[model samples]
Target: MHDFIDHNLLARLSALPLESRQAMIGSVAGKHRSPHRGSSVEFAEYRKYVPGDDTRRLDWKAFARSDRFYIKEFEADTNLRAYFVVDSSGSMNFASGETDTKIQYARRIAASLSYLLVKQGDAAGLSVCNDKIHLEIPPSRSASQLQHIFNSLGELEPKGETGLVEALHTVAEKIKQRALVVILSDLFCDPEELGDALQHLRYRKHDIAIFHLLDRQEIDFAFDRPHRFVDLEDNSTLVAEPNLIVDEYHAALNEYLTKVEAKAHDAQADYQRIVTDQDYEAILSDFLTNRLR
Candidate 1:
């Protein structure tokens, strides 16, 4: 599709619900990592067979080898609580087309995810921020929360400098329970600081997924003629020739992007760079499939 968001997108995503990679602290039963193993379909671990243990759960294959009774334990699944943290900084306004701003792309993805999670009978929340967190909604599984999330996303506009590092730390403290924290941003911030922010979340034991939103032109440096490049955040302007700076720009951008990706992996976070022109539905489906694994 030419656009990232479509009315029918949520219907497609409904078949593939969002799940957490780590044990989530949710009140309701759903599909994800759980603290205790039960009758869930996923396999967890094994334990010594006790006198009162169900014979059906006994592993005869292990008994044949060890000559001891061992009970097969399967992982327990629970409903996931997910929070969508979206960047509303000026740089998110970068788009080759009039209607496809980076922030718009991010909002669409966040809304879709929220819909999928809610449809799966899980909790979902929203956080919109730039230099500071503008809005924060606690996770809830209520059916009505979905419309509120979409309305909030529709009303917000990207502005101000990025405060991703600070904003991340702030949100981390707000979420007391373990959850799936999805961040949608252009990530125009200090590399080391962003790493620390991720580390903070990891320290709190939250599973993180980063959707690094970017316009294709930003990576390609494909401005046809020399024009004034204005800094969206600072109101500063730089006059340069694309032919002369393309090589240098690409080199620097590549190095920076590489560092961000490496840092995300180092912190054990799932990072995906989403170009504005790509199909977001396929990207999200792949991500959800991997999470199910």
Candidate 2:
């Protein structure tokens, strides 16, 4: 098992089924609802019978009530194909104290989720994005696919300026079918640009889930003395007295968070803002449980 795959966490979450909020279009019969009508037990809706419709699907009760022919439609069940988009930007290397680096945490989440998806007969894939989309593994249901994804995640490292926004746009254009697109990143890009990229995925009918990873120190700015902060992406340096700029820093952080949240809401993406100090298990558990609702 890879270091990112927590056996205990996997065991605990194994019973919680991963599900999609929207209907998917897949190639095989499975657990999730599909766009096309099929002979599933769950009732969808009824429509007036068409000449070429299956006669067995006709609802005699509906006919008796309205004196007109109607066809009973049931939701078609199909497999889900998911793509875990992980950011390998330089900013993702940050880790305060003993907590895992943002990129490491992302690896854990992506690997764990892909394991669960494949275990339940769904297809899972990976996209490692940094200055560009460095690698892309197409979704696959084969058991060996999990190992392949794990290997890719294990070798990934964070470097260079973030190109997450452009990478997302490319993903939106590349994926031809509806899929669950899970994103794990610090999301250090312009909120407006991020919003546009998210909207592109939404417009393509892909279900979006975002995990905005941040470190506690980055959020708290607890440094009491003057410190030199280096830009991980561009190698720029800033020497500032925390006392002098704490207020402005906080204000800017708050404004950024507000805009990001609003954009995510507007796109209807499932977004989770996480501090690195928190347990990833708890984070994932909450995410899985909420989708069950």
Candidate 3:
């Protein structure tokens, strides 16, 4: 048990397994649909019988009617391999008021999901990305893997500029097998660039889930008087009166958000915009429940 994991919350979520939205290819027999045919009870489809085909799988009744040998294929059940990519950029260190930092919020989400995934007999991995991907933990179903993921999450410190786009591209190329890529970040990079990265993952046939982490302050910009704003990614600062430029600021923010969301939709990724102020348990519950639907 780690600080990021709440035992009571884990108990509540234990019944809800983490499911994949698409068929997967795994090395074990478990839940979820797989592209490969196996001996599962669920019927898939019939195919023309070929040489070396298993005789036990032959449908004799179909052959008797059609005068051609056919083999019955049953849907294969496989486990899911999930990669949790957490953005460790300086912006992730931001928290408005008493709210948790973006990285802190992300840690809870990633750690909790990892626990559920492994507990349900799936595999889980971790990647912490800032200017570059700094850490990589390959997916594993071993029960002890949960502690490895938790330790990595607990030790993360947000710093440097974001290289999320590059990190995603790397993931798409590195993970030869299909997997569920769960990304948690503020997504400060260009939306178009991010779209290309996501498209790469889509092209590779990997399922993508993006949690666009944001602080309420970043969205509301509710400063009452003149304030000095600093860029967390860089050592840059700007002094401005909130009343004077609020409209322009909001316009820019709205445009950026729209583009990012549109890009996510274009890539067919499961996208969730999260405000750090919200309860993480509720957010994850909704996410897990929606997948069941």
Which candidate tops TM-score?
2
List candidate 3 stretches off by more than 4 Å: 49-71
lDDT of 2 by residue, 38-144 (tens): 88998999999989998999999999999999999999999999999999989999998999999999999999999899999999999989899999999999999
TM-scores for all predictions = 0.92, 0.97, 0.93
For candidate 1, the TM-score is 0.92
lDDT per residue (tens digit) for residues 215-278 in model 1: 8888778888898989888778999989998999999999999989988998899999999888
| lDDT comparing candidate 3 with the true structure | 0.94
Reference-based TM-score, model 2: 0.97
Per-model RMSD to reference: 2.6, 1.1, 2.0
Which whole-number lDDT from 0 to 100 does residue 51 have in model 2? 95
Off by over 4 Å in 1: 1-5, 50-67
Task: Rank by TM-score, highest first.
Answer: 2, 3, 1
Q: Candidate 3: how many backbone clashes?
A: 0
Give the range of the ten consecutive residues with the poorest summed lDDT in model 2.
1-10
Pitting candidate 1 against candidate 2, the one with the higher TM-score is: 2
Q: Tens-digit lDDT track for model 3 on 106-136?
A: 9999999999999999999999999999999
